[model samples]
Target: MTRCRAWLYTIICFALAGLVTGCWDGVELQRRAVVLMMAIDPAPDHPDWVVVSVQIARPQRAQPPSTGGSGSTSGGNKEDRPIAVVSREGRDVAEALQTIQLAINRVLFFGHLQALVIHEQVARRGLAAVLNPVAQSRVVRRQIWMFVSRERAEQVVNALPVLDVIPGMHFTNLFRNQIILRRQYDATIGGFRQRLVTPGVEPYLLGIDGMDPRLSAPRIVGLAVFADDRLVGWLPGDDYVGWALADSQFPRLDLTIPCPHGHGQFVVNVTRVRSRLRVMNPDAPRPKAVLHVHVHGMIEGGPCVQKEREADIQVLSRQVQQVLAKIIGQSIQKAQHLGTDVFGIGRQVYRMHPSAWHGDAAWRQTFPRLRVIVQVTTRLDYMQTYRQSALLYVDHEG
Candidate 1:
């Protein structure tokens, strides 16, 4: 799978290299506006109209060294900005995009597009109007990241970031780091499309809100759940982390556990994971599923675990295991309540028990009532070398 993906990316890069290097027809490269990011929202007034926005890479002119004489500052700070944002509304997504192209001077080029942001409300309405075009169009790469915005997506595409000067750079960077550092994956348009069409599984998108005025990469709110193409519900904030732990493979996550005895908390960076989710007794009525996760982690912080003893380490591992189990349980309960199978449990059921597993509608009813059991085991590593917390001088309680 890994090699196939690598080859697939290589072929795409090789194929699209020409689009970026040269001009389109007779138009100069400088005259074309490279759209770095795009956002879609339901029209403010029109019940069925769509609002689309694009962030174009601002072209900078060569500036001569100021000999303290030339004061050609007509454009003010606008010339120094890295991107430009344009928005327009139309009856549909493709129409809105065409209207935006007419509104801007330069031809709108989407070959270089990096990210797509869809307002949560618009997502709930349905994404076929948006995603259908994206799928058939040869220009936009299916690898672009997709986000469901908690706030108006226009703000996400317009606001510049302090660190990433370029719009959507933060998310692109985070996507790379998520795979490399965290050993996890974020939703890509290609993956989402597959999920959308494949039965027995539902699609989910990473959630964001560009609440910050300065436009740091959008804040991660949670996950936007979907039943087919329309959004069903959300898993607000850290509530999604539990789902992440169960669904993703071998992710290096920082989990904070309360001090076993006292008033402080400790953080553990878990890695080197051995995990799997199995459909136990798929033939039985109301089939049972077991999620077994084993992770080895090292103490990363806090005043707990000051000493390196076998007994103490064992107890600490148990505590971490309990917390992980609780989190997994909560995530499972939330997913079941929403009646959207984000965990791919239904897919597994179909694979194992094809006869018993019916179509999506039948599985949907069974999923909510399905019995799921979570088992987590944690092992603490580097206990001997872990840094001991500083001793605080506590006066005798009066």
Candidate 2:
């Protein structure tokens, strides 16, 4: 009985201690600040000075002490709260950020940041200075999306969207959708850094600019190509489509194949795409790359020609394959001639033959002289709608 009573007493004492001190690390929501986006641009007066723009979430409008009626709407007043662009002049990015601290009320928090928008002028100068903070911060995740804006980062971030109140949130979702659906190249900061570190692989970032918000259209205007840590050039608009198709990372793509025999056009959305690259060295000859692409897709739309005939399907498939082969081959040639390794062919070669990597010259020296061959094969599956016959007859002459 004495032992049982001592055990009960110990349990009661522990329960009381737990109730007294439960959570010491907890923080009130009002004490914390959230950042939406950040932008870096060049200062006009001082050529080396940097301008920093930070978008912070505003607190909900407080209610009156008596009635307790809130002033904010159910959806939150995201648009009314204009992001304050605080411009500071300093010799370097670190000093600029420190200087801004004096002008702002809350601490500059970066946990919830969506993107880091850098201006065109700044990108040309180089990103090593400004990017130092992001790379060093333990709180900042490496996957944060980065972009080069043609307009001033301030204007790009402040542009109000007609559909969504907060432009930053909308822009983040838009770019993310491009990767989820495989519409454009994957340009995450982490992946980009890896490519930059890897020998012979050039990194690329997409250029983002706002269109007329009334029409709800946002577009990728161009691409910002990088050689290691510096920006080299920009590839304009759909021209990057070829680069994307050539890259093994962006294999699945949508293409509209036009019929040469006046049968109109067919929209083909590739489902599974695989590319095999081989590097052959024949007795001191310059290394040659041969690429083989195998794909399967469904016919989105086209005029039915010999719809049920197996021979016709085979002919059409072969023709489509030929067209794809030509387009892809052209893209590869363009990248090689431009001296860009967007396809990572050099990296493949390094993996295949480690000895060749150490002995051969730099990728740029060999890229201009490298030769490439492309072969493609496409298989078409069942039509989107099954009601139609393989061959359709307009009129039967009996």
Candidate 3:
């Protein structure tokens, strides 16, 4: 009986402890101003300083049912409450953020930050000064998306979309949309910082800019290439497409390539892209990189000669393969010219032959001289009934 009673008491104690479980230092949600996004730009008139801007979400209070409200549309003055974007200048990101905290009424909360925007000038200067402080933060999540804006980071954080008023939702929508479309490159802080410490492979981020001068909306496009922690150059449309395709980031990409006959243009909606980059003779004075990309897509649309029987898709596939090789090859060359190894070819060399791989300085020296051979295999899942157009084909013309 004594033993049974002791066990019962212990069980009761455990039950009480379970009931007492709660955050010991929890703060009420209303007391904290949630930061939606943050931006870093060069401070005006302070070449050595950085301006950090954070967009804080304004929470609307629920009002009681309008007492005999005369068909009023808005719930209240809620629409007037804009996402408060405030900036503070300091020697570095952490100091700037600390200053902002002192000025704000509520404690600045970053547990739910959506994005981090860095200006073009800031990127060119180098990201180490800005990112080091951010990486040290305990609350800031690394999975949040990162972008480099061509415009001032201030403009990106301040601009409000008429269609989407929920602060930072436009960025979220654009980012996720790109993923869904499988057309553009995307970057997250966690992945990028990992590459910072990673061997051989450099880092890249998605870019944002006012694609049109007339529009206030920011468009996500292209890529910001970085050599180690410093921004080197950017890859434009075609180059970005090539990088995305070769890096296995794009599951679907639409391409308009010349027909096999080389006279007219045709289209193919490419999908299931897979790329493998291999480095041969890593120990030699100069190494060779062979990039093999295998893709499967359908002949989407284009000017094609309607053959009496189904056209030869093998020829069409071969043409597509060549075109892809050219596209990917050009992108690789651009990266080499920029002196940034955007492709993980260097990483492969290090992994395949660790002893052969020297330090970064040695690798960078060999990279530009390295010749990359791009081989693409395009398989048409199925072709349309149409094929070669004799009238459109110019066998004898350039």
TM-score of 1: 0.82
Query: TM-score of each candidate?
Result: 0.82, 0.77, 0.84
List per-prediction Cα lDDT, in the order shown.
0.74, 0.64, 0.75
* TM-score (C-alpha, index-matched) for candidate 2: 0.77
Per-residue error (Å), model 2, residue 296: 1.6
What is the alpha-carbon lDDT for the whole of candidate 1?
0.74
RMSD, each candidate, Å? Answer: 10.9, 8.7, 6.1
Which lDDT tens digits does candidate 1 get at residues 1-398?
A: 99999999999998898568554466668779888898999899998888999888875632321222333223236566677788999888889888888887888777888889999889989887677766677788877888899889988876655545555666578555543224222377887878877777898887886664432567767788888888988887445777777775445777789877866988898776665778867556566788776767797767876777766676677777777777777777888888899888888878877887778888888888778877776666754653222211111110
True lDDT of residue 323, candidate 2: 69
> Which residues of candidate 1, in runs, are more than 4 Å off?
1-28, 61-80, 174-186, 213-215, 281-285, 385-398
Total colliding residue pairs, candidate 1: 0
Count steric clashes of candidate 2. 4
Per lDDT, what order, best first?
3, 1, 2
Write candidate 2's Cα lDDT for 1-398 as tens digits: 99999999999999898789656855456654556777788888888777877766554522221211342223334434434445566777788777877777667767777778888788778776678877677667677778888777776665544444455676777766564225232476666677777875677787877554442334667567765566766766444655555554444667777764757877777776666777676223466777776666766657744364666566667667766666666655666666667677778767886667742237766765677776666667654432211221111010
